[model samples]
Target: MLGPDPRTTLVWALLLDWLGQLLILALIVWIPPALDWSIGGTQLAGQYPWILFCVLLYPLLGWLFGSYTVLHWRRLPMLVLIQRLLLTAAATLAAVAIARWLINPGEEVWLVYRRVQVVWLVSLSGWSLLVRLGLRQGMLLPDTPRLLLLAGDEERDRVLQAWRRVPQRERLRPIQPQQLEAELSRLDVAMVLTLSPKIHRDPALRSVFQHLETADPRWIRVVSPERLFEAMQERLPPALLAEQGLNYDDLPWAVTFSIQAQLKRAADFLVAALLLLLTSPLIALAALLIWWDDRGPIFYVQERSGWLGRPFTVLKLRTMAVQSPGSPATWTQLGDRRITRVGGWLRRVRLDELPQLLNVLNGEMSLIGPRPERPELEEELEQHIPHYRKRHWMRPGLSGWAQVCAPYASSIEDSDLKLSYDLYYLRHFSTWLDLMILFRTIKTVLKAGGR
Candidate 1:
């Protein structure tokens, strides 16, 4: 798989982007009219209708600017994206200006002279930029090449050579077959993009992979150089095939849910509300301890990758000191030094994450689903973890099936396996499954399973 398939992500992103633009436009429409404040008095009174035309123009400009496509490969070069956005805004404004002149021929030319369209253009561009940039940076951390052990050295070299021509090939590490199993055991290998043509002849590799399947189902098992390639390519349609960087497994939600999405939303709201009410006391205590231990703010509100790859601020009790800021959007570990004494206890009891209930209430997360991750981490994982970004289809959660089933994940490989459990949850997300997870989460908390 090239990366995370983002079809569903694209749909939701476009919807939200358009919705946000409409809201801003609506506000502009009502605010000035409500105040009875005309923009230049006479001619501008009902003439403000053109503002709506300008407003509608902005999001269309954004779409053309590639705002919708930024999340496709996890991170597009920021400068390049910005440049495209600016150019698109300019073109869109020009088009709008032409249309305005064509429609309202004889209106006072002085009124049109204000160039107030710049306000809509700049504001819309800025807002869209922030949404895209914040979202991209929030969910996807900087890309670090993952260590990959290709089981077929000859085929691996060929694939590596082919991909190396592309400049963004920093995300994969091709290693020899002899070193594969040990690396897999060490949890160092992000995936085994196996060109296992020799699988028919080599019982050894097959047996090793069988064991690996139990330990890490999320490991990439690519059979390079023949039938497997054709199988994968044939599966997807051509138009969809062009955006081929993402993987099949990336969209767990599409494969998982067969019913209406309303049920999931209702579950999230209800569960998040209930959890907030029930855990208020514990949350307060956790906040006090966090403040006392670190002499800083109680909550750590960092952006996490949410449903459809949108950025949402995830709430957690501050576990780290203010001085030692986290490596920009990295994953937490079992024994990270940034953890304060009280914070450590809070993590053990899973109390630190109580504040995520606020995120759930705000509709930024779900009650039970795949754990929302740092933006940077998600980007890195998508590079090596096949279908990694697919977990973003459903809203991220406070407690998840993967969180319960997997041990504390300290590395990318650990994350990959946890993804299997996450995919399982995405495939089987329902009320009963959520209840099961909730019940199990109670036991896990009592046992101090989190760290």
Candidate 2:
């Protein structure tokens, strides 16, 4: 059982969500006038632009809040999903209220009535979650892309298991080689997937490819499981990459050498310099709290492995009590006794990393990339995890693709999962991707979405 292409599902979900929310807003604005409710003598059309802005704003904020992401809706707990949707709506409302204050402060202009505000927020939240539920049940997109698996039994089972790990398997139909042409003839066969290159050996299937030049070929997209994972998850797993006879180094290694690297460096320096200026007061307050809590050193500096396995001294606000000499430092666990109360807050809101702006300025790290690991642990992790050393292929980051997408990694398995996302970022680092990481990082700070 395989679901439709991730790109297809994600696009459809976002478009539908925006359209549905737009309808909800339209009804709310129009119904007020129909009920003879006074709206500052402005016609409903006055609110049309506002409505369009909000409808667009929800999904944009939704992206930051992880309301809409790869696969959009599947296997996530419904409670967490609803919480994200409500958070997105609440943030959008706050933004709108701020705009209203600046635009026409302290007045019920353009659907700003307190009563209508409540209805608007509740209605949007309800409709957002309702759209998610519809996507979850596959009721919204009825015309799902159908997949046909072209492989032997063992290969077919491998493909099935891989899709199952994405946890979106229910539509992959495995057929005998003899049936390839018949399956291709079906209009619903949106993707033809195979695990082996020998698929062309079948003379019948061969004829289909030969005649595909004349037939409508766009309907039959050919992809392998590895390519499918790369497209769907946007990450190249070490094993899958190797299985395709590709080395990790064979990747388009553009992370540090491309023009994006030069642009990233300039952006990092300017942004970091400005952020250090703007955030200095906040950092001072945090440092005072750390010192007041336990009269300990206010900063922690450690040498961490960096770009291409070089080492750099990373600086961070001390989030744990200073230990005596020869004390074995350990990974900080949730609710660790070593963490002070203020330290826990700093970690939750990610203030502990503020000092790294200096590192970003110095070019030891990036504003977005794979996170650097402590040198003491980096070597061991490289031994245990496949392609783990690839993390040093580019500069580390203050907040990163791994930090945003993956849970805090405390074990080997967790490290592998994080490295997958990091590799994806390294492979596709660009301005837009950096902006996305920045947006999600902001969301994380707002929600204290991490430990």
Candidate 3:
């Protein structure tokens, strides 16, 4: 029943793309010399270094852009495919420009570099398109691993509808209650996606769950209806929290206090220090702008709930005017008149968040976790949202899964959705997942999609 893990699929796809690019580079180098056309009056031998540089850099950039992420390729949309190509080309060109300065290739070599860049852009784009098309048509690999669904009629229909929207829908096989035992005994099912509440309560089904767990601990996943919709939107699903007589102590908190927690803390400190040093000039510029605009305080400090629901002073570059007298705590909305002209640009590019790197370095926040909420909002949301306080199970972050996936939570409904994403992070916390969130955050900043 064991099959290729979804995580490794991305590595395989990346290797395939690199191979295709290598072939194109070889053709570009070999064919020109065979035809007696001197590329910028230099032999192809000298171009190998630059070609090798690109071969190494392309995959790194692809990974940075989430091009190699399994989620991206599993349901490859046309727009996402195009975005990957664009990011690849952009990264390649930027790498070339940086190399040109360092290598200081003379005028003759510079001409050759420009020519190769043009050819590479055209060939790589065409090759990438062909590879993606091949993957979509299933010409590059065998059929996807099949998912066995165990659920009641209503849940079965809902699960099927969700899977239908996924590009890998053909891999799912639904089993009826009467046929479940027989199918389990005979079929080589790799994964079981169940939505039936009975599986958690009924003695017989609970035994099945235990047997499956004994066979492969990760094989069976009890997903909630809300999780099903989240998956359809391509967001990671939160762990099912609705269980009979569930206790607060049953939550997955070991990860928050494990060796990985230590590693995350070290990373936050080191990375935050490095970023603060690198962005000092920009921070200075922002301060000057804020001061010039209204001569108000350049930094805003407020109390927010952090790890374990403890209060901490969070820092931010002021992005709004000084509050008028008697104004109450409120969420920043789109087109809010309180935003100064300079602050608007800072918020758009997320420059206002730079100061929080200090908080990260001080051990009060991590680079990736749930965004901290103000005390006023936190108190109100805790009263309205289920499991709202669970978000404090980990340190609050400067950028997180919810910030990247959902818009700013300005209402109760938005807060509910944001909590779901936060819980998903807590349930599935890992170094790889954190890296994905960081990359997505970069993409978001590049697109000016910040709040």
- Model 2 misplaced stretches (Cα beyond 4 Å): 1-35, 43-71, 76-110, 126-189, 192-220, 243-257
Sum up the clashes in candidate 1: 11
For candidate 3, what is the TM-score?
Answer: 0.76
Consecutive 10-residue window with the lowest summed lDDT within model 2: 239-248
Model 3 bad stretches (over 4 Å):
1-9, 40-49, 59-87, 94-103, 107-112, 139-142, 145-193, 199-239, 243-257
- Clashing residue pairs for model 3: none
lDDT-sorted candidate list, best first: 2, 3, 1
Candidate 2, residue 338: CA error in Å? Answer: 2.2
The true-versus-predicted C-alpha distance at residue 146 of model 3, in Å, is 6.0
Ranking by TM-score: 2, 3, 1
Over the stretch 1-451, how does candidate 1's per-residue lDDT look in tens digits? Answer: 3333244455555665666666655554556567885533233455555555555566555555556656655357878777867886788768866876787645453223344456445666677666676555433332221435354556566544534322342355666557766666664434535344454357766776676557655544444433222222112111111244344454434555635456767777887789789989988888877777757888877888888889878767887777555556666676788788998888888888888878888888877878888787777878876667667777888888878766777788678667756755665556777887886687667757678
Q: Which prediction has the highest TM-score against the true structure?
A: 2
Better of 1 and 3 by TM-score: 3
In model 3, the worst 10-residue window by lDDT is 236-245
Q: lDDT tens string, model 3, 1-451?
A: 2334344556566777788887876776677777997554434555667767778887777766666553444466778777887787787887788889887976645333667776776687777677666656655454443456677777667556645543543355777656665655644444445545654465667666666565644444445444544443433322234532233354444634767767888899989999999999999999999999999999998888998899999889999999876577898788889899999999888999999999998889999999999888888888876677778988999999888877888787678767777877777677877898898888777767776
Q: How far is 105's C-alpha from truth in model 3 (Å)?
A: 0.9
Q: Tens-digit lDDT track for model 2 on 319-362?
A: 88788876754666667898888999999999999999999998
